[model samples]
Target: MDLPNTEAVGAIVALLLARTKRGDGMKPWVRLVVPLCIAVAWVHSPALAQQPAKDPRIGFLWSGVAEAAAVRMNAFLEGVRGALRAQGDHIELVARIADGNQARLPTLAAELVAGKVDVLFAAGPAAVRAARAASPSVPIVALDLETDPIEAGLIAGLSHPGGNLTGVFFDFPDFGAKWLQLLRDAAPKLSRLAVFWDPSTGPMQLKAVEAVAGSMDVHLSVIEVIDVGNIEEAFRTAAKQKVDGLLVLSSPIFGSSPAMIADLALRDRLPAIMLFPEFAQTGGLLAYGPNLIDLFRQSGTMTGKVLAGTAPADLPVERPARFQLIVNLRTARTLGLDIPPSLLIRADQVIE
Candidate 1:
């Protein structure tokens, strides 16, 4: 029940005092009840009424277009909803999408911070960096596929972040080597390779590919693709170079357009491999990488923890719990390349 207002309590006490003063045969018990009533009114004062808690707002920063990121976003929302279900707390998401433009991330992140979000969720390394720069105190949960958080100095350590940032990060350098080996296993005669890279994602994947290309006796024609606009040109450059195969490196720009890249690879008859399983599923020859949807969901769950009063410093950094290898036999046949039985057997999914 709501407590009475100060004015109402004052009026009731004033009425009781007037009755006592009139002395119209009032019982001794009635006089005693006057002080008790005053004490009760004092205890239930309006000043001590409980205020309703404000709903928590989460800032979402993404480096890709909304349409391309829809599935992942849905998965993240599902995870957040599941985590907060027991608490019965409502969450409001304030999203800022870069729409495939890297330059706009910092401004978007700043805007989210300026809106006074309780927690921030950033996807991709660029978005994460921008969110960190925009706010030093706001807790951040990130989903980054191409960065080593430790090497990048985004956190003090993985086990205990020691700061206001924690998220799912992929160690792309070590994972990059696996892409080359898988491609080679599918196309044993691959001698010259074209590497489609995005500089914005960092040099880790490129360096890893370079380190292994020579040992495998393959010549590389590295093509730098800065945005979606440059993807077609990159493919054309690879075709002109007469490279035997293509290795598409990890980047939000490329990750957001798996279908386009896959179509280009098929059009150019280039046996290609990328870090997104959607690439192979869409038409590319092979894809081996962490499950992006699951990773985003994991980040969402962590964000819920931050919203539930746990400090970001106490939440440990995480990696993608699931990895997948997808192979498209139809794409291999179109390129006139034979995918080894050994590779096909190892794939988690094979599209005929």
Candidate 2:
């Protein structure tokens, strides 16, 4: 039941007191009943009643294919549900999937913003860039693995974003170099290495690998895969170069097809390393990097904060706290390469 307006209640109370003070010839029952009836009518007045609150709407912008990105989407939803459960709040999710088409992100982001989402959750660098372009004021929680938010001028710093954008980011260049080191450990004669890269993810990971190639005495053959169609050609080029090993950098396109990439690597007899544990689990020789599913979950938690009235500028940017090294002994044996015992001991999981 809605309470009467303060002004109306005060006026009625004042009238009753004034009548009593004036000693009006009215029965005590009549005076009390009259005021109670007026108060009840005022509360039931339509103009004075409070309206119900609308649920918050959250926008999800993804650059990967929906069918292939199911696990990541589920993890993110779990986080959002967990965070909002405490407040007994419900949210309407408005998702815009690019289906691995980078060009469609801008239009999809614009549509989400026009739909009036309270907060936007962007997956991958392409989607993040599109969301920022579509709305300058919308709160954006990003899950990006390929670019440095600071270098890209997306945020002020890690501790304080100082803008309407903040979430999980993987910016450590050395982390890319570590993938190369792991590949070398699995295949000691990794002289010529093929780098599978997606230009849309920016050049952070590619540049990181390039910077240490000369020092490591390794020659790099960068094969850019912009579209899903280019994946097969990338492997063909790697085969033409007769590369000893492959280093698959981070990108939504590559992340969406771990099994396909692993199968191709095995067919080419290439010892390969990728940044997702799923790649190694599927058949790739080695995988070492942040857990992407957990990173998406973290982004969802941040989105929940935004919906709970926390400004994006006040929320601190975060990095993936947990990383995993996965080694596939079956794949190593299939490639005729023996993974070092030292490397296997450090692995979080070893699949045979």
TM-score of each: 0.84, 0.85
lDDT of 2 by residue, 146-249 (tens): 88999999999889899999998888889888998888888989899999999999988888899988899999999988867789999989888989889999
Model 2 clashing residue pairs (backbone): none
Worst 10 residues of 1 by lDDT: 27-36
List runs of model 1 lying over 4 Å from the truth: 1-51
Clashes of 1: 0
- lDDT tens digits, residue span 149-260, model 1: 8899999999999999998888758777899999999989999999998887789999999999899999999999877788899988888899989999988888889999
Estimate every model's Cα lDDT from 0 to 1: 0.81, 0.81
What TM-score quantifies how close candidate 1 is to the native fold? 0.84
Model 2 RMSD in Å is 16.9
Give candidate 2's whole-model lDDT.
0.81
Model 2, residue 239: distance off in Å is 1.4
